[model samples]
Target chain A: MIDLFLFGIFPYIALVILIGGSIWRYATKQFTFSSLSSQFLEGRLLFWGSVPWHYGIIVILIGHLIGIFIPSGVMAFNRIPLRLYILEGTALALGLLLMVGLVLLLVRRSTSPRIRRVTSTMDIVLLVALLLQVLSGIGTAVFYRWGSAWFPQTATPYLWSLATFSPKVEYVTSLPLLMQVHTANSFVLLAIFPFTRMVHMLSIPISYLWRPSQIVVWYRRQAR
Target chain B: MDVRAQVATVFHLDKCIGCHTCSIACKNLWTSREGAEYMWLNNVETKPGTGYPTQWEDQTKYQGGWEVKGKSLKLRLGRRLGVLSNLFFNPNLPIMDDYYEPWTYTYEHLFNAPPSSEQPTARPISKVTGKFMDIEAGPNWDDDLGGSPVYARNDPNLADLSDAERAALFRLEQLVFFYIPRICNHCLNPGCLAACPSAAIYKRAEDGIVLVNQDKCRGWRFCVSGCPYKKVYYNWMAGKSEKCILCYPRMETGQAPACFHSCVGRIRYLGVLLYDAERIEEVAKSPETEMVAAQRSLILDPKDPTVIAAARMNGINDEWIGAAKKSPVYRFVKEWALALPLHAEFRTLPTLFYVPPLLPIAASSKRGKYDLTDGEFFSSLEDSRIPIRYMARLFSCGNEEIIKTAIKKLWAVRTYMRAASVGDISDQRATSAMSELGCTPEEAREIARLTSLPRWSDRFVIPPYQREDVIQQLTSPIGHKAQVGFGSNVPVRRGP
Candidate 1:
């Protein structure tokens, strides 16, 4: 119980604060841009890193949810068996690509002394958290050998317990320590969700779906 | 007879299988370039789940749309941070790993290694942030109540129980959940339209699709801050912002958007409708009852001959109207009045309407603890029982009545959009559009003169070499092949 409270509940509490703090900070920061003429070049590293990393994370998360949520009975429908292979394989591949992209971004930030100067301690901490999540997840994927041992039957029941707030640490501990770490890290990440750059991950792309399509004619201002 | 028309679409959530076929279709058609891989102009997300791009609905956090502080200039909310805000916004962008790490099995290894009895275990070669990051819950997380509605018809916390137990629980709990698939509302008065500091974003004069002029975008990121939906994506690499173009090209050729067309459930509708642009501000400012009623009044009925005439004058087509008549959207938005607009109080006057699904009731539990009269279970199925305060909060100009009335008006807006066709317009309306987009009367006349011209630039122009630079900057940042940045220090070697 203490372990559950400390590792599971306490981390969740911390995650909430971190996430909430990250979001509040980001919001106020964004609110500061009041001028139209001011030009602050956005780092290309931030842009590319944000998009691929975010989108990749989304696909991966969905794939993870499927692995966690779908029942074995449902997996039998519509050649659902094949879907697991395809979805899991796709996730693995995309995850690798995103990992590469993120590394490039990190390298760019570090090597570019100018960017390095601008880099904050919070940025480093956020990076560490993200890196820990990825490393552990990847380790779990590798150790589990990508669904060979029927993890859902074991892991899901425990997850179901958490949903109802009747969590049993033994069920979680029954899995490999790596898996446990992944789960704990995930909750930590969730707790910190509202705080870091991670908050942007919550942005809806709906505007991209229904934005208007009127053409705008601009009169370019020539050099005075 | 005016023939001018605007184009619009309606997406039915039921028909969407979440296959991303439309996303792929749109990607192949437009966003497949180096700078666009991360962008999903078309993406489908299960509600209750964090949507693609994350917490997109709550504008207070992500900061999208338009803000009207300056002389209506466009800016990026992220870049606009104050010096203090900058310190706070550090790495305003979440690291790639922070979002999620990417990984893949070595293809060569997979190809060479023989599979075991089970599928060959995939191993990761190189990995970035390899695990899932936070940012999961959505804006309506508490109310979304997703999952198999039938299974949990009575209980808020859907659980696995015996049939008898479930039935017993149902009598006591008597709860229901609905699936609401939504897309861009293409509001009548778009916050994004008003928030642009550069006057770069505009609503279509014909159908009402709002878009940003890429070339005109100075990357102020104001839209990022002002829009409540946070749908706009800043192309940091391009020094611009990009959003949904409503498949204008497809609409021009008379087809639904990729997502709507590709929807396996066939729940989408496409058309056009005329609205009184003049009365928008007045309607928006009035009391909730008047606001909703006024909003509803703006919805022009295509069946009304006068409305049809006005529509035709704007370039709407009969085919569009006919399709709209059969449209599921019309039934949901207008007739049954089940669908409603999202966040209407923001008062951008969104166009998309969603019909909340009616899931069946589960069997009764424990006779009737809440209300047991004899052997019969009490019907906890009253629509009134569902707290509509959230709905009201989304659309009630200031009061609940606005949401109540917006139901009918949004239905009307759906009617108009279902009939408007691209370029199927009256010459007069074309001229009006030209004027609105800042073309001189002579230029408008010239465009009209060349209406038959086969070739024209469909995409808005970027400054000379701007498009090339944007692509370079987005795909290869710093050292990744094509470095795209200010080449200030590099000396041009002239011929000695």
Candidate 2:
């Protein structure tokens, strides 16, 4: 029954909250769709925490997308023992790096008076959930071992099964307790996403890389 | 010809007394709010000394303004990529110490102090920290310290002068300084506009006053480091950026900005100046040495038939055009060429012009009975107490020729006026001097009136910024006219 609720009803709820809440925020309070940087007030730790955290999470996120979205391809590649080991090693290294960045950031927030003053209650929740989620994922990988090969058959099918309106708790109900917790927490984090500064994730300003610099918008209406 | 008229300003530095009445007026009007304690939209500083924010011109530290790379001007804080990289952290932003920890005296201490035989005095407390603290520095701490080696000797503009010349600056006989009253330059190419990630800062198409949309500002703080003049300030409490609005409230009502109106020296001149908007990009990209001339060339003759026709085509009415024709700023900055923009090397193409001060000639006792006066005002600037190199650095882009011409024209105008009124000097000599210095007799007479004896209306030719054209779109024009202050209608304060 619990598996049914976690795998079935919660995914849709998280998706609805994530999409609906973000659109509402952008519409009503467009200015708040920002990172709201505290680096100007306290910077030295951000240099160490932010740079590694950004790059490491990006690698891990891309790995997750590849696993869930194109599982057949990922499984085909993971068939070879050498390839599986190489892929597993790279993923573990990134997961470790993400953990290090998270610890440093938490230390920075607690220690720096300026950053601590600006740090919101929602900010603490977001960081704590992220750290726990990453730790659980790392634990499941270490104890159970070889998630790359098994995840396609278990979790990927279960996730894909949710898309077809069929509640398939049977696929992952038998998995380890840590894995179950990891999956449940990820969905809850998604539900909490819009309520926290983590909403800044949606706005990366990636267009600025290619776009021409120094463009100013005018408030007037011109005839020509 | 995309002719749009910008309201320009000229500050005659010679007349400026550094009284800071302009600063006080601006403060009382605009920046007196709770979070805006540190802001001074208008401030006067003694030259040959560190300015308000202490070494603001040290671009190496502050990294404000643009950099000249060959023919083009680039932001000193890099292009879009660099801006995005530094978007999270601005290393170059000024700290409280740089601008002084804006303090107010705890006058209540005088009332609350324990009864004492000696006098009870109030102590200064930091407004930011709200704690008792030692009073360190202020907006103009180095005022009137012209000969102080610590302040005047540390000026960045003194780079052009030799060691001996710098040392001579503090000598009793050679001591010289001038008041440079500063406000936002309201440039043709504003760096603050470019650096704003939220697209909050913009120059008005109607009048070209650069302003920030307070609602849209997310306090990213790039604008603080973007403006080379250090005019843009961050409101830490409000989480937004603010700057000189050019008193748009007063301007909309066809009145001068508080700073200009309250100037004790009457050094300020405000008026509409018609310029070709199309030339802005090209002029901004001009060679570093040629930027000032290029910017000046952008200003179109208000009386020119072609300019008038183009301005009309663009919806500029006859009244604005008429104001441009009589604009005292246009006469000083364009026709007479007595005024030049401050720090053209920044390449922001600032519209505010300065009529450089003509210091008293450095009288040498060794020459004994040398003829001190050939009837030229301030002695041709060659024998001036203030270094020409310093003034050139301040006004021109280190071009001495431009400063010389302006000084000479000022001398000719002064001579012409003295002859007309005082009658100690002959009319023939004044006429000859005007002609020699490239100012015609008629031009000199006009300059004299505009500079010395301008009527209040003549000094400030405020144009009617016809908001009715824009306002009529939403509501009844008459109803809107009852409610003044253009942006006051909008939700300008921070939203919950």
Task: Assess each model's interface with DockQ, reporting 2 decimals per model.
Answer: 0.03, 0.27
TM-score winner: 2
TM-scores for all candidates: the values are 0.45, 0.87
Per-residue lDDT tens digits for candidate 1, residues A109-165, read: 676543453344545666677777777666665556554234566666676766677
The native-contact fractions of the candidates, in order shown, are 0.05, 0.16
Highest DockQ, which number? Answer: 2
Worst 10 residues of 2 chain B by lDDT: B476-485
- Model 1, B216-334: lDDT tens digits are 45444555445555555554334455677676545544445666666555555555544555565555554443444565556655566876666555444556555444444434445
Against the true structure, candidate 2 reaches a TM-score of 0.87
Q: Per-prediction RMSD in angstroms? A: 24.9, 4.4
For B85-178, candidate 2 gives per-residue lDDT tens digits of 7665677887656777577887987889898898888778777656678877888889988436777788899999988777777776567788
Error of 1 at B427 (Å): 52
The CA lDDT of each predicted structure is: 0.47, 0.79
